[model samples]
Target: MELHDRRQAPWHDDSFEGEMVAVMTVGVPGGEVLLETSRLLLRPWRVDEAVVQRELWTERDPRVPPHRRIDEDGHPTVAELEDSIRTHKVWSTGLLAVERKASRDVIGYCGLVDSGRGATGEPELAFELLRRVWRQGYATEASLAVVGWARSSGYERLWATVWDWNTASRRVLAKVGFIETDRKEVDAVHGTTLFTTRPL
Candidate 1:
């Protein structure tokens, strides 16, 4: 999964509760639905959680574009994020908040996004986790849940694009059943974007 764009792209790019019963309610419109895994909860972002989003912006790698980062003027302020959360309409295919079930702390986001890079209705699989949660299998776990969600929702396939340099993310995608294809979009500054897909 590309770890960058939350609303406009595959890259660039939330929390939780309880004994963690994994629940998935299908047939929901606007992506306003909930899902859970043994250690993660995938759900919509609350308006008050803009701070977390802002923190994510700050944590982005320097390779990310300035606009996606905090920016010189702090363009994507928490207030701006709050307003975005108030207005953005997450589609049936959307990026959901990933929360750590045990601590109820939102670690990041993992879900499908319409990057306009695939066939109609075939959303891209995207995920980004806090630097603190990098190696505990959270991305793989959350991604598996999203893949299962997409398969159950009738999607025929799912795509994921990752920077060739992002080996960690590539590993996560491989673990979740995505296979790399020859497709590539070269970004001279960041690296080549490698495309991968998994058939449902």
Candidate 2:
């Protein structure tokens, strides 16, 4: 969800490279999800769950853009987020909520998204977890499930973008079979964006 508006020349940065769930649920907007992991459930986000998304906004690192965070004006307020959830397609090709089975608490989201860096029909893998859930293997677990799902869905390739300094996410991506490519976008304020790819 941290796409940049500024475009820059792509270059080779040899910094690093790296990088699911199941449940049967219907009537959700995310295309009849049947994805689950041993301890997680990847399902469509609910309208009432905007508060969860809001919490994620609060937990974002300061380096994250002001627009993506809760600004002084409280932009992207819960009501706006709820409206977005009500209207956003999310279909089978959008991010789904990552919910822990034992507690039924949603950690965050993992799935594919239409990224500008990718070709038509080639979606990018995206994921984010609550700070409290970090290092619990939830991100890796949910990401693996998404990869399997992408492979089964006939996608021949998947892309991912991460900040250069985010070693944690870089490790997760490497663990999941994504290799860092030469393509990169540098933002002076936010840092460099690294692109990675995996072929199914």
Q: Top model by TM-score, which number? A: 1
Candidate 2: stretches off by over 4 Å: 1-30, 91-93
Writing each residue's lDDT as its tens digit, candidate 2 over 1-200 gives 22111112222222122322333344433344546787888877888888889998999888876877898988789999899888876623368888898999888999888777887666899998889889998898888877776665567899999999899999999999999999999999988999999998
TM-score of 2: 0.84
For model 1, what is the alpha-carbon lDDT of residue 10?
A: 19
lDDT of each: 0.76, 0.76
TM-score of each: 0.85, 0.84
lDDT of 1 by residue, 46-119 (tens): 87878888888999988875777888887889999888877775522377888887899888888888788977
| TM-score, model 1 to reference | 0.85
